[model samples]
Target: MAKTLSVAPKQPQSCAALLEKLSSVLPKGHQFGIYHLSTPPTKTDALCHPPPDQRPDRTYCENHFLAVTIKSESKPSSSEPHADWRPVIVLALEIFIFTTAYSSIFFVSKADSTGYLHLLNLPKGTPSPIREVSSAFLAYLIDKRRRKGIQTTVNLFARAQDQYLFPGSIKNGGKHVLDDRGLVKWWCRVLDPLLEEQQQKQGSPWQVVKGYLLIPGLDHYETRAFIPRTATSAANWVLGHPLEKISHYCQEYDWVPPRCLIPKYPDDPKSRYRDELDEEASNKEQNSGAWRSVKTLEQFWEMMSFRQECSSGRMTGFIWVVFDPKDAEVNRGRVGGTPMPNGTPDQAPPGTPSRNRHALSSATPKSSPKKTFGSPSKQADLGRVEQKKKAKDKKKKKKILKGPIIPRQPRIKTRQRNYLVDRPVSSAYYYWPAEGRGQKIVDESDYKRCTELLLRLDFATLDKAAGSTRRWIEEVGMGSQWGLDVQGKMEMPPAAQGSGTAAGVVNNLSGLVRKKPIEGSEGQGQNGAGVNMLGAGLVRKKRKESTDGAEPNTDGSSHPAPSTAEEPKVNMLGAGMVRKKPKLA
Candidate 1:
């Protein structure tokens, strides 16, 4: 007969053994919780059961719960051989749960009527995944707590709730929701203090704070709390350049706030957002009042934070020199060798001597005739030699007097074209006097120094200096036309008209005829008065008669005219007929 093997029923696995198995398989940095189902399926004793309504109701229990929360650990238990296997099973389950959670967060097959949550597939390279996960976990925790009607508050949960909700709504917590501004504010509340602490510890401001603040969602809070107090400090944080360099550049270029020499962060998204914000603010101001009318710290921050578009294909921090029309005219004057109005012939600039002086010096002096008893041939030779010498001297004098023909400096043809090869001289080369007559000359070395300094300045430095300059302009009452007009109220005589011109003559004659009655001729007949009409015709007649040698009556036939000293000076339509020099005494 075949030997029969009897098998005993298999025993249920112990919880410790299961836990050990889970611990072994789980990946590092992962935690898993295990719970037993409180409601196990039950079999009914149908034979003894009465009718359905009279039978004990077994429809459903009001509450189903999990028992014993257990977490998987990375370390294996030494007491059991299968300890390492437990965490692996737990890790697999955890992966499934994590994937499910992420999928639900991103892509939902159906919409929920609750309206508290939304599902959106985030763009490929967003930084919101971690935050989203945290939010979802918080939501789950809040729901669990509410279901239990628990009144206890977890500080971490409270903080997360505040970060996820609108300001002042955290205490009246409901569901966890993401509020961008609130999140940014929360970040500032945490990071700003940390930045300050780091600054204190390092004995200098932290540059990383600027980078953190400029991250897309966080930059909105720049003016709200995190920006450095001073422009120089902000520059140092935003741009890795010295404040002095920026200030010097601004001073050189005369660039005020919102008109920096260099464009900053033109391609950065944060910068772009800041620019949008600035543009919005600018538009609002324009609509509500004057554009950029109010100079506040808020405005300053907006201006500094804005990024300019470089359609010119220039690099960030590139220096652009602008030549005003007046500057170009002045430069042209210098290149053309024009003499200074105040300077005399003796004081003419070198290489540009006075033309009159040159003419006088170049004239040939007359030579006395030579008295010599010489042969005819010798005389002829001597004469020829003298003529040749004279001609040579004349040519040399012409060359000397005319000097070198220095060509005019070439002008930049168009404003749009950049002069990469021929950059403009720096402001230091031209001294701007407080009196504002015009720029004066300076040494070449100073110009070079200023140019190099300006070129070295980065965007942030220039931006900071611009803001400071604007503030200074405002403080000195030069920001608006009204303030400038008030400062420019000094009286000045009306500009003189061109008296020699026909139009000017007519104007002057009309004024004289209207205002002044001709002396001793008031009662003259209309015919005689018609000839005496104050105009170019009468003036021309008087001039022609004077030039043709007509003499003024000194025989007292004409009425005694006013003395030259007493006669009022008048234009007389370009004719100077002031009572012909009164015979002395």
Candidate 2:
């Protein structure tokens, strides 16, 4: 009940007729041009040999070879219609080259069948001629190649717009080409299906092969057969050969020598093969930006092995495959009830919750404190308590002796000078009396006598007296008493009154002469020294009494009794020598 499908066959065109058609459509003065260069006798004999057994059968394809070249007129009149056809020719050449470069080769069994001559690979960007030809010729050849199970090497550098160059394009006739590492990954993804189909077809192991071919639009071509190797030795042998050795082998096999194999061209200094000896030097500069330094063949092979392992999904030692418990059980059950491999445990029985074995194994256990055996004796306990009490009492005594803590003021340590050694006895040693002291001490004789008294003191006593006096002056804002200036001395408050060294030194050194008490001076003390009590102690007493509502007897006579806050201010010298005030009242 099957119906026979009949198709019309394509008619062939003569070479003269085809040229005439192309010339009519081309610009004025432009004609189809063809040049034939006969191959050398040695190369012709090599080409006549049959292809290797591993290669695809090409018996169905036409063996006839022809090379087409279209030449454009060199010069044309500017005024002529459409005179400048250079741009058009260039565009057509690009299309022709790109199409032929990537198009698959086709084979025909009949001599009369249509087939366009395959062009040799050209160097990239090389100038070429073009002819106005139908793309139908290319489509016909690809169709025949598909029906005959023939394929061409992949073109990685083809234009992106050429969809047939892509691996999964419909125009590729379901054939694949592994041209790059990315396409290798694509191949790996569907490798299981490919292998299953191959097994089903009972095909030879080397029946299908991937090709990596790079053909620059120049005389040079690079091609490699990607035969699958079952043994590691075979793969290693293929990849381990040096590029130069491989080029030499190809030359011996009647293949055109690659740019890398040729001797340096005398006329062309930029020739690629001109400097083999300089490779190491040039590579040292060129590989500066490379990610890895590949210096040894062993290291290179190791890196390649790692990359191949990664690409083929063989590096699974670090990859853990976790599965749902239910799914894992189902998979295990489907596999003829076989136990899980690699010590993988089976799912827990129904109704029993699964425990996380990893979490339990990794958990740390808590430790408990150890216990003592017996209680201490009462006597020992009492002795311990007594010792603790004694320690507390000691701390209390130390705190009491330490007195109230005072925060230390920030100060810079300065170099201290010893007057006895650093300098001779000067006026700076004289005791400068405090405010309200008797005028007798201000005399030059009194200052000299005071300095002599100070110089006579023992070393220890002199040091004590100097420290106390320096501290008092610093406290009372009278550092000039010690011949110290504000810029050179530390600012500090006066010392407390418990120490009497400073007061004794000031009293003796000043050579103060007490005045006789005048009549009517209340609370006057003997010796009339109360008036000279203008030193630090008396100032503190007067300040305290004044705050208690007592009028200070500035006449230097005696301490006054508490009185009313309102009192007339009196100016007085030591020993009640009162001075008269202005009568503005």
| Cα lDDT, all candidates | 0.26, 0.25
Query: Which digits, one per residue and each the tens of the lDDT, describe model 1 over residues 95-134?
Result: 0000110000010111001111111222223333223222
Cα lDDT of model 2 overall? 0.25
lDDT of 1: 0.26
Residue 386 lDDT (model 2): 90
In candidate 1, what residue range of length 10 has the lowest lDDT sum?
Answer: 93-102
> RMSD of each candidate?
49.8, 54.8
Candidate 1 Cα deviation (angstroms), residue 248: 7.5
Candidate 1: clashing residue pairs, number: 14
Tens-place lDDT per residue, model 2, 1-585, is 111223222221113322333334333323333211111001011111111211111121112112232222224543334644211011111011001111122211111100111111222222112212322222222222221111231111211122221111213222222334334222222122222233345532223422222212111111122223333313221222222221212212222112223222212122221232235335433222111233322333334334422334322111000001223322221111233232333542222223343443343112211112111122334666899999999887854345688889999869853221221111111111111111111223333343233233321222232333234223322234321101111112244222333344434544567656566765766555445335642343333246657676677776565565444466334544456787995
